[model samples]
Target: MSSYLLPAIAGLLTGAGLIVAIGPQNVFVLRQGVARRHTGAIVAVCAISDVVLIVAGVAGLGAIVAAHPQVITVAKLLGGLYVLVLGLLAAKRCLRSNEAIAANAEEAESAGRWVAVGTALALTWLNPHVYLDTVLTMGAIANGHGNGKWAFAIGACVASILWFTALGGGARRLSHLFASPRAWKILDAVVAVIMIGMAVALFASI
Candidate 1:
């Protein structure tokens, strides 16, 4: 039990560190939270996605990834381009004068539920960083725990669940702060910076 405890704690901390980074998936979740639109569904999707990835990582996908370097290269090229596009769109949103958080469910409902779900899936699955972090990095780390790898995976999975829940649920309370269009613009600007920075970093690493 003591052996498992340390790895579990390590997994939790490592998972939190990776997921806490501002990325496309997180920005989308924040937007949904602010809009108060299908927040639960989005949160669940993100958390579940992480869990699946993390489990795969722990199950030895990391070894396969390490053996084939070209996989990372291809993922980097495609993911970086995708992130770059998202950053540009975010920048455009910031420039628009009408950038405002929805104040009610009706306004938020303008976007179809399926659209939101599809976007969330794309943001989660399309990013190369997700593969790097979960399947490779986390997988390697979990395997380092030897017999306790499953325990570590559980800790990491729990972290993903908690973080998404907090991020999506907590944003609702801050809706009042984003009531102004200027606030939304500022948020978009910040998101644009994060996304573009990530894109550049992703490409640079390759």
Candidate 2:
């Protein structure tokens, strides 16, 4: 038990280091969380997706993914373009009048639930970094534990779940901070820059 416990701890720390970074998915989750809209669905999608990827990595799927450079190339292009569009949309929101911004917020609340869910899924699965981090990197680390690999995988999955849950849940506390149209605009501007920067980085990596 002690041996497994150590590996699990290692996995947890490793997973946290890879996941808690600012990225498109985190930005989307934070936005949805602040808006207090479909946060549960978004958190669930992101956490569950991480679990699937981590488990697949532990199960030796990482080797196959590592060998597939073309797959990463395709994902990089698609993900970069997708993030770029999202950034442009956010930037457009920043240009709206206060009244228009408020109206857009309302429209977002009324938007289809599936739309949010789909966006969450796309942001998670379409990014090449997800495969590299969870599949290749985490997979190799867990496998290093030999028979304790499953324990490591479990720890990593827990880390993913806890991080997203906290991110989504705690973000609502910032609702007071985002109460005004100006505040929302500011948030959108920040998100726009981050997303666009990420898209540029992704494209450059290819």
Candidate 3:
């Protein structure tokens, strides 16, 4: 059997590095983890989406996308808008009933996997920066790894798995800690601030 150890590990680390930041995905993961709902779904979402995109990056699509000037411009605009919306939603979360968040989590419980995957795809494919990270950053990193480029990809994937697994698993323990409405409110408030700041920074780049 062909071994994907190096690629898997690289994939894992790369994915973790890119995703460990304070972003929407992290927010969603944190919220879901704190709630203890559909833990497996969340993990699958992060992992599967990573595999698909990493494959695309390694397949040369990353190179193609990097060459397009217009696409990059449009992507920056969209990323700014998306982050703004996410921030607004986060800010509004403080006002939302915990019941609503819990309910949405319930409704979302079934599709947690796809939700994660789709969310991953949207965030990556939709944001030109993802191309810069996965396709560009990861791709460049993959190059020097020699035959281990493939192994590096695998490592990146593994990193994602470890993080998400820790997310879902750790969430199980955090549920009780977030039992109060106040805690959720505070978290939402902070997440809103982060997202809004990122959104603002996006426009500054233009």
Candidate 4:
């Protein structure tokens, strides 16, 4: 038990560090959080996805994935295309930025829940960077712990849950600041840039 302590702490810190960075998923979560739209569902999706990925990585799927170069090539191509499309959509939203402010509960409820769910799934599963971080890098680190790998995975899973919960739930506090359409436009523009940049980077690496 004592031996697992260090690995658990290491996994927690590593998971937090990797996830806290600004990315398309985080941006989407932040936007949903500020809008108070399906924030709980989004957070659950992200946390569950991370848990599944982390489990796969720890269970040795990482090594198998790494062995298949073609799989990664395909993932890169698809992921890049998906991200590019999302970036374009975000840019378009910036152009028509009337509804950028926070939505009332009724408005948020009326919005298509399926749309949000689909977008969340795409932003998560279509990002090759997620595979690289959670599978390859985190897998390598977990395997380094030998028998303690499961402990590490648990810590990492916890980290994901905690981070997404805080990010999605705490964003409402800043709702006043993003109340303006202009602020939302600017935010979308930045998200567009980041998503496009990530897409470009993905293609370049392939």
Candidate 5:
């Protein structure tokens, strides 16, 4: 159906473009992938969250969220703090494990299911931008494009699933490639930069 086609294509592009970037979600997925942790579950959480947000946006609730300045401000402060703290913690982990990571790979498996869920949820719900971007912007465009709101939401949701799945699996492969303390340092540094950048962008955006 042409109606669905539009949403699918839009969703694919949105998913591909955003996922390809080395953003927070990507970092989390990659961490799972490399550690060979509960990659599927983590990826699934992100995909599901995306679908929910996109649907809400398309259904018009996204507009309500964007309009509430206080909510956005609160999300910014909270999300920023969360990101900064997480980034610091990750950096600390990297430093602590720099020498033993490659040797004790088994011990370095991801924390737990709850940790992954909390990380992904904070990355999604805590940032008001997710609401604005996927729900508000994508929803508005999808809805404005005629009777293709669900279609677009579907597209984006599908895209998110595919991307997160791939990244989570792909990152694990890097254990062989970046098998050095320097590599962990670099990755941790990059994560720190991304987290800090996200915080700055979020706060400045307000």
Candidate 6:
């Protein structure tokens, strides 16, 4: 019991360190959370995706991925293009007034569940950083524990669940502040900049 406990705790801390950063996935989750649209599904997709990646990493797929640079190169190019489009869309939204933004929200709500889930999946799976962090880095660390690696994996999964739950669920508290059109515009503008910057970084890497 103590064996599992120690490794699990180590995994929890290590996973938190990898995930709690400001990335494209975190940005999308926060936006959906504030809009209160398909927040649950978005959170679920992100967390579950992490679990799958982490498990794969622990299973030694990370080593295979590390050996294959072309896979990551493909993901980087595709993900960069996708994120660039999202950034441009957000920049367009930033130009709209309060009423238009509100109407857009309403329209989004009607069709956003699946859309949000799709975005969540793309942002999670397409981003090469996720592979580097969760799969390559965490997987290598977990293997060091040998017999306790599964316990470590469980702990890392738990960290992902908790982080996404808190991020998506707790963002509602800021919804009141986002009620103003100007606020929405500002938020969108920031999102655009971040997304674009991330896209640029990904392209530059390749």
lDDT of 4 at 154: 88
Index of the highest-lDDT prediction: 2
Residue 29 of model 4 has an lDDT of: 91
Assess every candidate by TM-score. Answer: 0.90, 0.98, 0.79, 0.91, 0.87, 0.96
| TM-score between model 4 and native | 0.91
- Candidate 6 achieves a global lDDT of 0.92
Error of 1 at 26 (Å): 1.5
lDDT of 5 by residue, 141-186 (tens): 7777677667767777888887787777778677676667677777
lDDT of 1 by residue, 1-206 (tens): 89999889989999999999978899989988987888999999999999999999999888888899888888888778888888898798788755244343346568788888888888888788888898899999999899999989999999999999999999988888986778878987988998898889989999
Off by over 4 Å in 4: 97-109
Candidate 2 Cα errors over 4 Å, as ranges: none
**lDDT digits (tens) for residues 1-206 of candidate 6:** 99899989999999999999988899999998898888899999999999999999999999999999899999999999999999999999999978888777768768757878899899999999988999999999999998999999999999999999999999867788888789889988999999999999999999
| lDDT at 119, model 6 | 90
lDDT for each residue of candidate 3 in 1-206, tens digit (9 for 90 to 100):
24456555666767788867666566667776776665667667766766666767776767787788677778778887887887898799878887887766546456556655565456545665666777777877776666777777777766766777887788778888876777878888987898788778768876
Q: Whole-model Cα lDDT per candidate?
A: 0.87, 0.94, 0.71, 0.86, 0.76, 0.92
lDDT of 4 at 91: 91
Rank by TM-score (best first) = 2, 6, 4, 1, 5, 3
Q: State candidate 5's TM-score.
A: 0.87
Model 3 whole-model lDDT (C-alpha atoms): 0.71
Instruction: Rank by lDDT, highest first.
Output: 2, 6, 1, 4, 5, 3
